[model samples]
Target chain A: MMEKVAQMIAVTGAQAVAHAMRQIEPDVVAAYPITPQTPIVEYFAKFVADGVVKTEMIPVESEHSAMSAVVGAAAAGARAMTATSANGLALMHEIVYIAASTRLPVVMPVVNRALSGPINIHCDHSDTMAERDSGWIQFYVEDAQEAYDLTILSVRLAEHEHVRLPVMVNQDGFIISHGVEPVSFLPDDVVKKFVGELKPIYPLLDTEHPVTYGPLDLYDYYFEHKRQQIEAMKNVEKVFPEVAQEFFKISGRKYSFVEPYKLDDAEHVMVALGSTNGTVKYTVDKMREEGCKVGLLKIWMFRPFPKDEIQRYLTGRKSVVVLDRSASFGAEAPLYEAVKSSLYESASRPLLSSFIYGLGGRGIAIEDVEEAFEKSISGELVTDYEYYLGLRE
Target chain B: MAEQKGWKDIPIGGTIVEAGSAREYKTGDWRVLRPVYDRSKCIDCMMCWFYCPDLAIIQEDAVMKGIDYYYCKGCGICASVCPKSAIEMKPETDFAEEG
Candidate 1:
């Protein structure tokens, strides 16, 4: 195989995702404008107006309609997608579950924002974390490049024969969505070939072979149908690596459920998801230079909750701190809860601690991450209750 | 009755692969009041046929025929729409002993 040189361009995470969408040229894009995620649809719409792609862009009245339109289009066997942010995602909650339950491979790029009460338009995992059980495969990205790559990769993953489930590719609001970075783009032809055409199963448009979707499933079959979704999610875990390997051939960027940085032989570790991983990586490097044995574990696939991999990575560590960007309100933080549960059966379990940070977009400075690591190493971080990072006492 | 399928046997996503499979449901058993057509007073205006939600008002060559009890949920719309009062809502118990 010849060496593949990607076309590198600097753009915001939203534009990087839009560039990916433009390359895929899905049959349908139905979206409503919301902060952070708005530029993604705007750029795609511009591509449509400029005839850069032949996508049928639907200007939806609300995020609910946006998701509903994509669901309908996918049901009709069209490659379909939508984008939304915090409140917009909250509005689309209904159809979001339907899209997954109906087994439509609709790809959505969600700009992670804090679910509102104070109406903040900043970065937090509250939006997608609230949807952990919605049955869609979730991929949280660290940078513009991952956001761009996963948006393309999610297409193949969602439409895979055994995994006919929707995928939500999440990037932090403003932090990644609006932050510009150098994102390398594969040639349009490479992406087009990689994603390929969506061969939908039991499409509603197949008039000759008529099929019913979203039928009234009550007590008789609802439980069984849910069980099928469970099986499909299991298939996602199996197929994710296969699809990621295929993507590696083209983009040359390897991906996995969990990404560990300087983890081997480390005594202390900090685990997180989304863009916070970047901060943790920087802090890990800084701490390592000071002769501290610390590392970071970045969770890429949060839906399947890579329990085994997480357990394998942090098992023998002296201590581990889970940085959760969202709180569960009267419970352990979301990612913290998952990590603790994943390590519950491990005989060599690390001293685990939950550090809630970045709620409503409170910035997590390098010093804040350093503090968490230092506290974990010094045995000062509490395992009994949650600790707040960058929170004023 | 057709055999009920386990999760593995049925298509994924609760999709009904066979179109119009509702025909097998036999909703006629849900009826408490049945509509009986009186051919002697029939006007054949097609009102009953036009108003029947379940398409249970049988028609032959565009001429009104008797109701199809297999699908009719015993809704009185057909009887109420019959201009000549040719259709009457009779208690399903009236012929409980008969088919």
Candidate 2:
């Protein structure tokens, strides 16, 4: 007799994300449903009603209140989860930063979508980019498989004592969130074992010993508290890989916070994050076949800014191109600039390039990256903070 | 103002510290100005005490006081009912230093 396993289940990426949440068996989930992010919360709420998953699902009145509730719940030592999209995440901005710095280890699944200017809702990086400074460790997933895998690893990573920051797992709205695909879900026992038993944190609403978590820090204590957040982030660069190794050992699907594809002796490489890296990697493999030296560096973890991994990957490269789906307004895209600074200390140099592509849900193709490589080599390289690629010329 | 008599002296809650800390407290976040008074206001004919929503205004030994801060948002109902000009709306920001 063989045990039935969900080796490959055909489900929407939203379902995969939601199922993963149940597998983590969070203690509390408070979320207000918005378009492109509604189904996930709905599915989880149903999970609660059916007793399929033992969790408290609080349907909130508004996104802002949902965030506030999660912060308070998490501070009270609950394993909390929430899902939201563009404007929803925008509504959660203030608390999002607090959630991270408070080190409550709240995990959120962000369905990446475009911010409304003229009003459009599809796949884009605008939402998560708006939260780039929110101190949450962001993992951009291109497909349902990665979504399921990333969601599980998030709990493992965030709960690390040294890396107690909230994490955001980003999946492109409508693309990955709505797109149905066969995903591989780890068994409940397997996931439970991997996630381990959640330990109750002290002073977490323990009236026996009242303790403050998110206090209004005076100017004198504010910087020190902020340093504490940064110091925890610094530990993640060391702890993430170790945790990931344990994940891979059990699940057999491995991911580094930073993945460099075909960079092994390449003269130039394109560095980008999120689901878009799939296209870049395919293009890099094709270019390699033609004896071209172009490669791809895919960023799996955007928050901790894997400087050491980046420095190691870009060491011997001649040129590097970074593509961002969101614009930074006054400066270059956050990831592009972070990579440049990380490489600055490296003696093995590469002429770094920057491109702000796919803003406002615009489509990007393999040709866009191929074109970027051409312009970079011909010295038509972008001299500005960022260049708009695949946008109306 | 005589229609509104004794305002404070309302046993908002049996609290010693917060009740006496300030005789009057005002919170108008509810889109209406409300005033609460200290316990020294007398002539409690139960006018202001009867006009309250939760009946939060009460008379203690012939003196009227409002609800304590714990349960009292300082809606000023007690002050509104006081015909004696004993109740005045005090802003919550007055105690911002305490926060």
Candidate 3:
């Protein structure tokens, strides 16, 4: 039974990421340490020490500097990247905006963790939620294989000239980030051939040429600056799948901006992102076996929010309940809002709903997901509504 | 399969090099490099004027400032280290080449 669960490799989650960092061969990785997330950076430091990877890894004063230094290195035309989670991601929030706004194609792994106002750090979307609008392409993974594969694919997708956007490949902090599973890492040549070379839109250090980046703006110029950022962001919808298609030819694990699991001919569905998608998918199958017409949506690309594909996936569906691990504070969950907007333009849109199920690393069991689906089907739960599913007394 | 070629091997024979590469400008060719100033955001800040690094920032009034990137490196330090996010970096794509 355990063998079918993917042979357990005698390696920690941090070591898995370390192995990935070596495979990606980033020219510069500058990351500081924190719980669970520390081992990833530490393992890369070990790679630099053991001469396992040919790269420059910087030890910075804080996560802010870690992000700041990578921005500087990437702007100077190096294949640069880093890693962080929760509070660390929040610390680098200012520069994360700069990295994407400047169009430096840096890729980083965000081990999902809860934010700290009350000091909790066990796999929540707070860290990622805070940075959702920061202009990076966010992807969530279900397991170590994805953590390994997406890390490689991220460099390719982020660096694609058409996209040229930073990407955050997130794995749930304790669940996937700390889990050990056998990952058949593609050979170095295969990854190199797949990811290809780095050609920045404008690299700063070229002696024969010079370019300006990350400009400031006033009201007169600010609007257009942001417009251009939007324009660059809008390009990703077409840009992502071309790279993904090529990656599919090699890796065999194909992905879209949003992944649809068993959605066809279905009347009920649950849209989810990140690792929980796996659990929900299994639950969907179980519910389907019980004669329920339900499906699952596993969203991989969170930014540039694959709106059209999302609605197209739901074209024939009857109802959708978005299961979000993060909340928008005083409003609907981000996933729920995105799903609503995607269906906004659809002619045959379904009754859509929002469920803010997980917060502060609290669990949203599969049973809760099934219960939400049952409620949506029988009209016991209103579609034009939001519910915090797992609130504890 | 997509073709992979180095920029060096691209043989870009007719690539247009910017005028800054050569020092000469034809009379009607050089587009005036504009220094967009922020009047409301400006605090009589000479930081842009003083730290022109290339001395591109000009002090028109006692407080108003400007940049002449005829020598500006596009380094953006003036706009970046600015007290307020005021000044901007725009490329002079139409600058005339001088030889």
Which candidate gets the maximum lDDT versus the true structure?
Answer: 1
List of chain B TM-scores, one per candidate? 0.85, 0.49, 0.49
- Tens digits of per-residue lDDT for model 3, A121-185: 88788788889899898988877787877888888888876667799988889878777767765
Q: How would the docking of model 1 be graded?
A: medium
DockQ of 2: 0.03
How far out, in Å, is residue A236 in model 3?
A: 1.4
**lDDT tens digits, residue span A1-393, model 1:** 112446788899999999999989999999999997989989989999999899999998999999999999999999999999999999999998999999999999999999988889999999998889999999999999999999999999999999999999999999999898998889888998999999989888999998888889876779888999999999887899999999999988999999999998789989999999998899889889999999999999999889989988989888989989899988888898999999989989888888989999899999999998889888887774688889888
Q: Tell me which of candidates 2 and 3 scores higher on DockQ.
A: 3
Q: How far in Å is the alpha carbon of B83 misplaced in model 3?
A: 35
Q: Give model 1's share of reference contacts.
A: 0.85
Maximum-DockQ candidate: 1
Instruction: Report, for all candidates in order, the number of backbone clashes.
Output: 0, 12, 4
Model 3: CA > 4 A from native:
A1-13, A219-222, B1-99
Residue-level lDDT tens digits of model 2 in B2-80: 1221213311111122223223322223323335465465566667667666445656765564554433556666677
Give the worst 10-residue stretch by lDDT in candidate 2 chain A. Answer: A212-221
Residue A271 shift from truth in candidate 1, angstroms = 1.0
Query: TM-score for model 1?
Result: 0.88
Candidate 2 docking band: incorrect
